[model samples]
Target: MIMDNWISIKIAAQGPFDLKRTFESGHSSFPIPLKDKQDRWYLVMRPTSINTVIITRVAQQGSNLVAEISCPQRELKENEVQSMKKILRTTFGLQLNLAAFIEEFKKDPIAPAFELYRGIRLTRAHNLFQSLICSILTQRNSIWRWNAQARTMAKLLGEKYPVGHFLIYSFPEAKTIVNHSELLTKASLGYREEYVLETAKTLANKEKKLEKLKKVPTNEAQNALLELKGVGTKVADMFLLYGLGKMDAPPVDIWIQRAVSHLFFKKKEQTLAVCRDKLNEHYGKWAGLAQLYIYCWARDHLK
Candidate 1:
């Protein structure tokens, strides 16, 4: 049932909004690549059930970004609209005023590179469990490998819906994984299979845990996530930073270590702990944000 009327919500942003940069930051496969014919970005997501909603940034009128939101199952209900609004706002970082972060970056040594990618923010996972799984799958693996595994996981466990002639799949929920732990092996998860299953079961056991994590202090939340199987320091920090909306959490991988070393430590040798401390000291609350932008930039631009 296609409703003739689509609700138009205006989002005025504090900093410059660049949909292209945000999508290209190597987040995942949800946001479809640019299409000249559409002249906008399309995001397909499923927050509940197997049913999916397709959100598009339809237009930019002055300082506001107008969103055209629609779901295949039905017209969005009042509560659904609020949910979509919150998810979209968070996904696009509209609530994050980056003026101060950008100002601080301008004074840094890599200011030019950071400025070149100013509007790019961390495109977060759909949920906390999904973020944990992503971090686990990405550990010590190439981006290509993790993306392939993610796509396979999506197709196998996610609910499928028809969008025109095409079928769209959502990211698998923890319940789905908990119900079918063996299916993960087909994705060649290897040693991480057990960890993924355990994490899924843990998340599925309590619906309130993810919600509780949002309210917990950053250090406690990090430790709690660390308790889950396959979750290490980097994975926990990534979950805290991207999943629980804690910008103070900086997940420093080798790339970030190199970037930090070169940009801040005068290319001196430093431990990951020392590097993370430096990033926190310099970027403060925006440390995670700075880490993401610089990580992406360094991955592509730096040696």
Candidate 2:
């Protein structure tokens, strides 16, 4: 019943744990937070070396360990190791083909557009419920205010773990937040509190297939999300890109509309569908990554 030869060693990734956080974030599989002796946040790591799950943890001193969930059925052979290497490399941006692509773009540079926020990485690792809540909290609000709202919600509903000189907030489960509607006003979620509750209550029980979601048809996934109480195209795409790893998922926020509006179409009033088509044409398979990088860039610079 345990995993195969793949051991999920999450800590080995790096300090800016983008891929690890995405996998552990429940938007994919109910990413529950874990901790080590030093109270640092850890996630479940599934490595291919050994066929078992590891509740990977990082201590204050930065030591990493993989606590075996169960023993593997068999050791991963060399062929399997190579296969896993390929899968991991592709699935996660492990070895960013920075050399090849950076050379191509070197002539033009990353454009003045993407430079202001070169190093800002998204690090929020929460279950889809929390992701949905934060995304909903984000819509139509300033990113700063939305971040404030997120922090307020975390402080109000989530648990705080002290790690070295810093502290990280663990987002509460869907059931916890849904059961306490009054916390919204306290958390300053504003008008989206109802949306947050509705979405959470809807998925809190239904078994959602989120991990390895790239296999699912985009239309089906988008429709499924649309069926959720507060979820719409934007929310669905956010889940697809951030949680489910669909590189084709183009998440459209108002800021992005402005960024591409004049540049792509020579008009500032471009429609969402038009923008989607343009992005699909330009980014192709990795359109989701494009949207993410551009979204992060646009949000910071446009503001």
Candidate 3:
């Protein structure tokens, strides 16, 4: 009977929450193993120290959102439910205010591009560790390949639970990866195995440093992340933007490079340096969100 009870927590959508728009923004396009059926989207998190898999079903009900939180291994405790609520809020951008950014979008030079995909916000990982692992997996690989690698790693390293006929794996923690370093090989990480291992070890050893890094300025955070393995400029920017919630960081991938060149520079001859400076100047604090909208719009329109 305890398992039968689905703890429904209501999230205020007065900030104009758009579930579909959030996923469509391309932020959720990563291979994070988000399972959806009909209107209910399933998300799994391992928030507890004992590797408990918390399964949450989020759905839009009218203007607000309801999250049904559960745990297959055990009944969801109050603190566990509260932690799920916090993680869900972070993942869904529930606490973020987009009104100011939306207003600024009106005067943006790429206003049409941003308007085409409005209500889009950055969908972050459950934590900075997850974001760093995802960034390492994504480097120099096709979207398909990186997604596959991520799913494989999760299946091998993460805790999973059965829901009806389906089994979903939660995102693995740094300790999980640290213990099963051999599993990274099983996940087909190839040359990225060392980077993944080193990253996990670094996180495991440097909790205090990571905490200090989080409170620093964006430029300092970027520099700190760059010191990690397999973290180049783009990966550092990705970690800052999506992981640390620095909206000013515009991650310049190849597609974004081409998109910014065409839109702001008027041609493909613009360098990445020029493109980043010009766009940051134009959008200011909204640079990262603007990048997401412009990238999504350009992929749809420019192609």
Candidate 4:
């Protein structure tokens, strides 16, 4: 019989962490995270290594974050619990030490952003496949539209689990997506449907390719991701940063391009390649975090 109890785990941040800023940052491409009246954040995800869906409730307890995880379909095992901890750590960037980056960029044009969005971390998606799909969905679309599409896809394709009085869905697996390709049309993906299907097929057959991206160098990983359908330079870089945790890969989208041009190029238009190169040259390994701060700052101040 399935257990009704929740397993609680506490995770310590390496330096400073802000649970509210990180969860509401709007930096990630995953479906919007849910927060209840009690200030608890809820995430429904299926870790790649685990066989079941996990519902996690995260709330800040002093300096540390406490996660109450539940597997409604079955009893949570020891190995799965360990894997959940690792996944939560990765997803929330609990182990990242950002003191150096903050100290280095304290005087730069993006410095004000650091103060405004303090404790905002680079949040990752559930897994590589989900990241890839979310990247594809963001192409030529606004954040709200793409997020809605992703949520719709999850509702249509993902496994439904009961959490309290609510039912949540896990992001569908590649094999599940491959089997349900027709449902992509219903998700309002438009032209992205074909790309999502092809990518899902590739992942379903050779998922190790996606897993291996975590071990490879940044440029090589970007190249491999670029080979997939609907993946361009921006999409590849997005996957690199958010999917595989490559901090040096900063994606240059329209918003980032505008921000970079304004701050570094004196509002003069520059090519995407040049903008990306400038970010790499300036921030080096901290380019991804820089991009997030600048992007958020630009969205507010630039417009």
Best by lDDT: 4
**Residue clash pairs of candidate 3:** none
TM-score of 1: 0.86
Ranking by TM-score: 4, 1, 3, 2
TM-score per candidate? 0.86, 0.64, 0.85, 0.93
Which parts of model 1 are misplaced by more than 4 Å? 1-6, 27-65
Mark the regions of model 4 whose C-alpha exceeds 4 Å error after superposition: 1-3
Per-residue lDDT, model 1, residue 161, is 50
Per-residue lDDT tens digits of candidate 1, residues 1-303?
332455766677777676666666765323333333445544446564223555344444554567777666666777777777777677667788776667766777657765678666565655555667877887787776776777678778976654333455667788889898778889897788888888888878664477688798888988888888788888788777777678888888898998888888888868888888888998888888888777886897767
Model 3's alpha-carbon lDDT is: 0.72
- Please provide, for model 2 over 1-303, each residue's C-alpha lDDT reduced to its tens digit, 9 standing for 90 to 100: 323333443323332224333333222212334444544444333443343333323322232222222223446455654544443343344334423333344443234433443322223222445555666665676655666676677668866544334444546567777777678788776668788888777766542344334477887878877887667787777777665556677778786687668557665678777777777777676466456556655655666
**Best-performing candidate as measured by TM-score:** 4
Ten-residue stretch with the least lDDT total in model 4: 160-169
Question: Scored by CA lDDT, what does every candidate get?
Answer: 0.70, 0.53, 0.72, 0.83
lDDT tens digits, residue span 158-200, model 3: 8766664576766677877888887788888888889989988
Instruction: Judging by lDDT, tell me the better candidate of 1 and 2.
Output: 1
lDDT (tens digit, per residue) of candidate 4 on 1-303: 232688999988876678887766667847666677888877787777895677888899876889999877777899889888888888888767767788888899999888898888788867667888999988898888888898888899987766555666778889999998888889989999999999998889676578888898988988888888888999888888888888888989988999999999999989999999999999988888899898889888877
